[model samples]
Target: MLPLTRDQKHLVDQILAFTTDHVNETGPAVFTVYGDAGTGKSVILAHLFNQLQTAARTQPNSPLTQTTNYFLVNHPEILKVYREIAGQAPHLLKKDFQRPTTLINQLAKGQTTADVLVIDEAHLLLSQSDHYNNFYGDNQLRSLLTAAKVIILVFDETQVLRMKSYWTEERLERLLMPYPHQHVRLTHQFRMQASDALVTWINDFTHGHVHHLPKDIGTHYDLRIFNDAEQMRQTIVAKNNQVGLSRIVSTSGYPSTLDGGKHYITEGHFHLPWDQYNYTSTPWAELPQTIDEVGSIYTCQGFDLNYVGLILGPPLTLSPQDQLEVHLDRYTDVEAFKRRADITDKQELIAVKKQLILNAVNVLMKRGVQGLYIYAHDAHLRQFLGAK
Candidate 1:
């Protein structure tokens, strides 16, 4: 298990105390952890949930001795990791971890409630019914909130990638307005070794701004901009061979289909298929064979990598003013911008689509803990990025 920082430890202690205090309360209690990527949100949830389970199951003198609880995550890749961890933990069982939809369905069938629910990647929770996932609820979080006495969740609005699960601070605040709640924002980045300037550079770049690269960008982190996509893949492969967990990922505007066939992402000589759905128990990044596959936001989100090679795909272009532009026509991820009944304004819909595209870029760029290597499909954008 990963050790927590002093502040993170204090967060755990505070949340545990809050849970104990609200266990027998009349209405449901909510604890919302707000943080960006790599802010150690998931690790805090992991440690806190473990302690809750250990105390509820083993500590006879503790107030949580008999309290029932569950740990949930909307991402399947992340859920696999937690369940694997639980398999080895003495106090945590595999059954203790589940996807939010699964937990919600089971609770509905049994008409039962849990004392506590700890959720990771809560931003991925479905805000609308997704029949493909068998979720019939209007909102997964609302369902979970209704079924638990206390809900502890970590959310990042920037990580919201799809229209089906679109979220904002305002939307979340409105949902929790009826409940008793506590909110905390964690600012320190615990994953990347990059300096604050480099972090800000990435944020600005994804948010549609292009600035000259910082001179000290590589002092603490490996920052590289490659003119050749093939060379970038070679460097990432070498890094993977040396350090493990390094993978090449791309933005969504690639040739892809959901027909269960191999869809290749070819940039010059760097040709490989997009990451296939993993049927095995191991996480995608941990598999040695995955180094040849190009990961997407779905595979890499909420997971850390030693190094990431990012391909800004066809949808992104550089304007005359050097501003970054997103073209909806070139974006092939049709499912990402599916029309929602509640969102009907044409301008709002376009803005959301562009933001989602940028959100995917932001997520891929932040996956690297030690380094970020970038390549762009647009020639002008690539030149702009590589110039500095």
Candidate 2:
């Protein structure tokens, strides 16, 4: 398991102690742990799960015995990586982990009860059900609350990637307002080994409070803006050789074709393909062959990397209003927008699409721990980013 910082350990203590007192109380209790990418929320959660198991061993009527433990993770890659990191706490490991859709299916079949549910990356929880999960409530959050006595939802709104997940701090509060809940804020960031200044720089640029901020240049963050993708690729590859993990992540404005040959993405002169998702249950960042393929938001979210080569594609462009905005016509990931067939309001529809792209850019921009290398596909964006 990941070593928790002092801040993380304190949060774990609060959660474990809180659960012990309120586990068997009359009704459901909700707690929302709020933290951004590098705050180490997942590790703290794992520790809480461990403490629950320990309590179960000593006390037969402990929360763990009465309420089943379920860790809801988003992806198979994340699940595989989490299980590996969770280590010896098998009862606290992936054995107890499941996806929300799986739980929704179980609930639909009348197979679910009030258990203790701990959700990681709760931002990815779908706010709407597709045709297959028609029986699922208005969203998974409703169903999760119904099925769990104690619900701990760990979320970061900036990490919301898709269109269907409408979870915000407000939405979560509205859901929890009916129940007594606790709010824990993770103040220390250990994921990137990143300094406060660097995170502020990222926050500033991604939030559009500033445009074209320069790298801090020789201190904590090794951020570089590249005029060329190949040069950035070479730098990331060399970094991966020196230390451990590095990746080339792009906005989904790049097109891909699986055709007959090896599947690849062709964007002008750049011919990188996507990594296969079904490969041997290994983390995408750990796989050696993944160096040749590009990663999307789904694959890279909730994972950290040493060197990140970011490719900003067609969707991101400096507008006529002299601001960065999502150009829906230039974007390749139109499938997400197309799914919202019921939306009749023009402005709301456009706003939703823009936010999705912005959130994608935000996530791609923040993945690096040691370094960030960026290459914007549009010359205007490159010029904008390269400037201080």
Candidate 1, residues 277-338, lDDT tens digits: the string is: 99988889999999989999988998999999999999999998888899999998888987
Query: What's the lDDT of the predicted structure labeled candidate 2?
Result: 0.74
lDDT of 2 by residue, 108-165 (tens): 7887654577889899887776555443556788877776678887998877766677
Which portions of model 1 show Cα errors greater than 4 Å? none
Candidate 1 RMSD to the real structure: 1.2
lDDT of 1 at 184: 98
**Whose lDDT is greatest here?**
1
Clashes of each: 0, 0
Report lDDT per candidate: 0.91, 0.74
